[model samples]
Target chain A: MSKKVLVLGETREGALRNVSFEAIAAAKKISGGGEVVAVLLGESVSDFGNELVAYGADRVITVEHPHLKSYTSDGYGQAFMAVVDQEQPEAIVFGHTAVGKDLSPKIASKLQTGLISDVTDIEGEGDDAVFIRPIYSGKAFEKVKLKEDGVVFVTVRPNNIAPLEREERSGDVSSLSVDITNLRTIIKNVVRKSAEGVDLSEAKVIIAGGRGVKSKEGFEPLQELADLLGGAVGASRGACDADYCDYSLQIGQTGKVVTPDLYIAAGISGAIQHMAGMSNSKVIVAINKDPEANIFKVADYGIVGDLFDVIPLLTEEFKKVM
Target chain B: MNIYVLVKRTFDTEEKLVVSGGQIQEDGAEFIINPYDEYAIEEAITVRDAHGGEVTVVTIGDEEAEKQLRTALAMGADKAVLINTEDDVEEMDQFTAAYILAEYLKDKEADLILAGNVAIDGGSGQVGPRVADLLDINYVTTITSLEIEGETVKIVRDIEGDAEELETSLPLLVTAQQGLNEPRYPSLPGIMKAKKKPLEELELDDLDIDEEDVEAKTETIEVYLPPKKEAGRILEGEIPSQVSELVSLLRSEAKVI
Candidate 1:
């Protein structure tokens, strides 16, 4: 039951994102002894093709166009459709990043195929691939299998799958030129809010604050701890609504859903909306004054004290250990 | 200008979902318009007001969903359409829903189409872009701001940790995101006016789509709640002592740090 699987490698700021390699590993799993081909679409991304091969791809197809230097739904969709038409892969895999979420559906609709998005795990069921994904804001899980037979599309969530180690597999690199035209929507520019930090969705550790953090200046202490741990800083909707932090840092049903290895909640009351986003974290630590805060119910460790007094002490203690 | 907004009836995110007999228990559940779609409805009304046009809200659900459509009408949508598939389609996935919507909209000649970035219940964020694809139109998702003039549109879309500005033209679709606008509540006067708003109900046959043509491409094998989190150990005593104890526990028990 071998099948040809195509993995779409994503790039940000001229470097391949880690999820691209993770997707290659996923492609290898579902390929079932068939070929796993990686597709890279961007400006001057051909140099990164060999890296994808080392991760797991059997071959790489690089498509470079000046119009693809940045991502637009139309431009990427056209390029992907061209690749699909040429390769005729039985299945296509993409990392469920912003680009993937924005582009995959357009391609799926053009091909008139079903797309299983944000898949965390995959299994073989009688020659068919079954995708496991979270629904209802991670409150429940659903196993979905495509009923149609032609070509299947899927987007894998980042950090869920482990990427393959570097191996000297000399995969052939091929060049492709696609005619991308008639784009109605054009990206003028990408305005970055912050220059560099741990990507919240992909971070291994996250220290999140709520309204109890007080003011925009109040997050300085939380940021210090997060930087010390090499983790990301996140906020509840209450914090975002209160303008204590940008909405980009918000984690809840209406914002980003994250599953980090370690999640520390400080000065936050655990509202269900907020818990729906991060309750899936491996180890949760709640630091709040209220012993009866709902966050303590989901936390693996709780500290019933004022965060202002507790966070600095915790940071100092961690400094001693690390 | 003819505007249409896609609305969905979903369970309130606050309610804890109960699973029984391999299906979610629906009785006694509080249903409301998917919170995100409220932005779409509100945006549509704003757009219609700026330009001389009418706003129509559409949903695919059973009779119970009419209440949500009425709510949308009360929120300022000029009309509402309920494509009830209660008996026709037993199980509907994103593909089926988008297919039916595209089929019905093929002849509507809508100048602008808006939907929520994703529904809270499913959270796939697929239907808006899928419908636009099926109709061979332009689409953008996670839009925080939108401006329309004549046939051109400008939008600011939300990305990972920032925003991107884009320019597009009419006959386009965009999914509403947070910060787009504050959705208004239904006023007493508006609720009374909603009673007379045009509300139409259709079925699969009305769209000339057979149940088999738009059959769900994916099947759900199971549905169950996530594992319940166990009670945690609460550190007691002085602040300094609690800090030391937490550090020890992190090293010995959790092993995260």
Candidate 2:
């Protein structure tokens, strides 16, 4: 039942993203006692091979090219296609990150195969891996299995799967040289809206706000509470539409889908679109002035009061406790 | 400029989904063009208006999908094409959808192809890039801004917490993200004009693709709703007392703190 699987290790800002390790864990699950090979692509990422091995990869393949130092659809697609052609893995896995979403489909088309994307769970064994993914913006879940026999491609949603415990395993590391050329789309620059913090999708704790926060400055207390809780700050689409925050912070049906362990909705009214993104969180806390607010319907704990009074008190209490 | 927009008919975002026997119940369900694809249709109309060309909206679905295609035409697309597969293909996934679409578009002399970043129903965000790859054309996804001059293209796409600027060229495919532009509603005149617009229907045989050739590569085993959450506990007390109780619950019961 064993089958070789390839895991594409993702990197951002010269550091390995947490999703990369999670992907290795997923690859190991369906690997069926076969080798799990991790593929790392960047300008200079050879040093991360040992870490990938420790995370349960049996071997690591590194592809270094200047064009890959930053992610471009062409560069990453070319690099991934080359590695896929060389390795010919029975199954390929990637974290459903920005890079993965952009590159996986391109590779799938080149290989004339199908890709089950944003998979939250994996079952079955060897070539019969069954992937569970959300459809209709998490309203329903679908279990999908690839029908093709030769090779399969999948991208796992971040934070859904647990990574393997670190162990000292002898893993072989090899280097691959791929000619990455004829780039049509070139990345000029990336403009970050906020300083680095817990990735919203992967955060265990999330403090989110909505139009009830009132103004751009109203999010300060929520941000402070989020930092204290070691979580990311998110906003509902209503907040983004009101120009209270950037759209990147918006969590809704049209925005990012997040499932944190602890989700605090301060002032969010819980529009269906907003709930679609975070309703699956393990626990939800709603703090709003409206007693009849829709957010309370999904919240495990509801405080019917003004967030202006509730958020600061919550932050203060959390500060004292932790 | 020959512009093409890919559209899909999906359940309205606000409709409650009900699963029966591993399939979604569509009876009396309100359907609309996938929300994100509205941005593509709007952008296609804008591009065609600015560059002196025609806009064609294409969709792959059953007869019911014609309503969504007509909606796109009413939104200003000059023409509409529906590739009905209700009888030919038993299962349809992103791969098969893209393959059929790519086969149809291969000879269309497309200068610009636009589609939604991802369909809300599927949320895969793959078809645009997949079609682009199959046609050996350039593509960008989650794009918030796009500018075209002659054969040069400038785009700004949404990343997680930021924006990425890129430069590409013509004969490119781009997926419309949320912030791209405000999609216009169909005007009274536009709606009436759409009634007379050329809405062509094609079967799998018309595209020279056998059902077996474009067979879905994935199969769905089951469909179910996420577990329901218990009712919320509303604490009754002064602000200070409620805060204390909440903290206690977090530390002892939830243990997330």
Candidate 3:
């Protein structure tokens, strides 16, 4: 029943993202008391290997290469394949992040294995695992499992799984030298936008707006509330189309899908399109004037008052307690 | 810049999916080009227009998928191909879909390939990268911006809400995220012309793909809806009291804060 699970410890800005630790958590569950190895692939990432140990990785494999400073499917693919060839893990886990989504399928395909992506939950361990992933953009869910014997490859969505509690245990750290060759895609430069605060997808709390937010200035109150709560601000398609916010903040079927712990929909009418993205949130609070608004249907709590009045009061109240 | 845009007809995101006996009942569901794929269709047209090339929209589905492929043609794709698998293939995972697509495209010498970041209905996002892997090429997913000059390319990829810019080259596959380009609706004239465009049809035999060889590696064991939530507890009173009550509910009842 036990197995060796390999988790790719993904990083951004020289440190592992929260999802990396979450992946380790998932690996522990899927490993079924077997070895859980975390592979940190980057230019110089030995410092973060111990952090993985505290987070429950039984061992850490650091695959360093100069070409890996920037991520290309080809560069990372070759490097990761080398680690896989060496480790030959029974299962592989990755965070359903941008880098994970891009690299996972490529590797799974090369291994001729089935990949259950964006898995929100897992029911079993090893080959017997049943992976639950949202389909129809969160309108429905499906339970899928591998049909034949192969590597159990999966990608876990962010904020869905809790990372393990850190322990003082030290894990064995090893180094791997990969033969990097025939680089196809090259990174001329990486222009990072949206560095203002926490990432919207990984943020524990979110303040989302809609058309009722009215003007660009309307988002100011929401942003202030987000800052106060230590959350990120999101927008409905209506708000983005109205030019009140950027499309990057759009949350809908055509936009980013998020599953934060606390989601606050302010001045927003719950269009089905918008709900497709955020309906999976743990707790939703809809602050809108329309009592009949569809958002109230899904919200755990509702305040049927003008958001302009309610939002500032909510921010003030939270400031008192938080 | 010979381009291939992989398209799929998906259930409209707004429709409530009705699953019966482990299958989605599609009787009354509205079907459209997966909205994300529209960006790929639009970007392909833009790239083809800028550089002298042809854009071919390809899809694998039943005859019902022709409607979506025609829409792609009306949006300026040079041609359309529907690999009807209603007769041969059933119960597919990503591997099967990617294998068939790669088989058909093996000899095409395609310069650029485009797909949506994820299909709304399946939401797996594996086919694009899998096909690229089978074809032994490079790929970037969830791209917001793409600039191609000669053989070199520049892309701004969406990493969650943030962006990462990278440069790649030809024979590359890129999946479209939103904000790549506003997908244009089919003009009436364009729609009329699409009626006359070349729409080719193929089957498993044509691509030399055996159903067993490209069989799915995963199986769907269950299809069900999330449990319906109880009607929300609405707090009524003055703004100040309502805010306070909500905060207390979050703390005492939900405990999310």
TM-score of 1: 0.97
Q: Provide the lDDT at B222 for model 2.
A: 94
**lDDT by residue for model 2 (B1-257), tens:** 89999999999989999999999898999999999999999999998888889999999999999888888888899999999999899988888999999999999989999999899998899999999998989999999999998889999998876899989999999999999999999999989999999999999999999888888888888999888778999888898899889989988898777
DockQ each candidate and list the results: 0.79, 0.83, 0.81
Q: Identify the leading candidate in terms of TM-score.
A: 2
Residue range A1-322, candidate 2, lDDT tens digits: 7778999998776678888899999898788889899999999999999999998999999999999878888998888888888888888898998888989999888878889999999887676679999999999999998876857789999888888898987899999999999999888988997547678888899999998999999999999889889899999998999999989898989989998889999999999989999998888999989999999999988899999999899999988877
Best by DockQ: 2
Point out where model 3 deviates above 4 Å.
none
lDDT (tens digit, per residue) of candidate 1 on A23-71: 8888877787888999999878999999899898999998899888888
* Model 2 fnat value: 0.86
**Model 3 over residues B51-105: C-alpha lDDT tens digits?**
8799999999999999999999998999999999999988788998999999999
How much DockQ does model 3 earn? Answer: 0.81
- For residue B197, model 2's alpha carbon misses the true position, in angstroms, by 0.9
lDDT of 2 at A113: 83
If you superpose only chain B onto the true chain B, what TM-score does each candidate give? Answer: 0.98, 0.98, 0.98
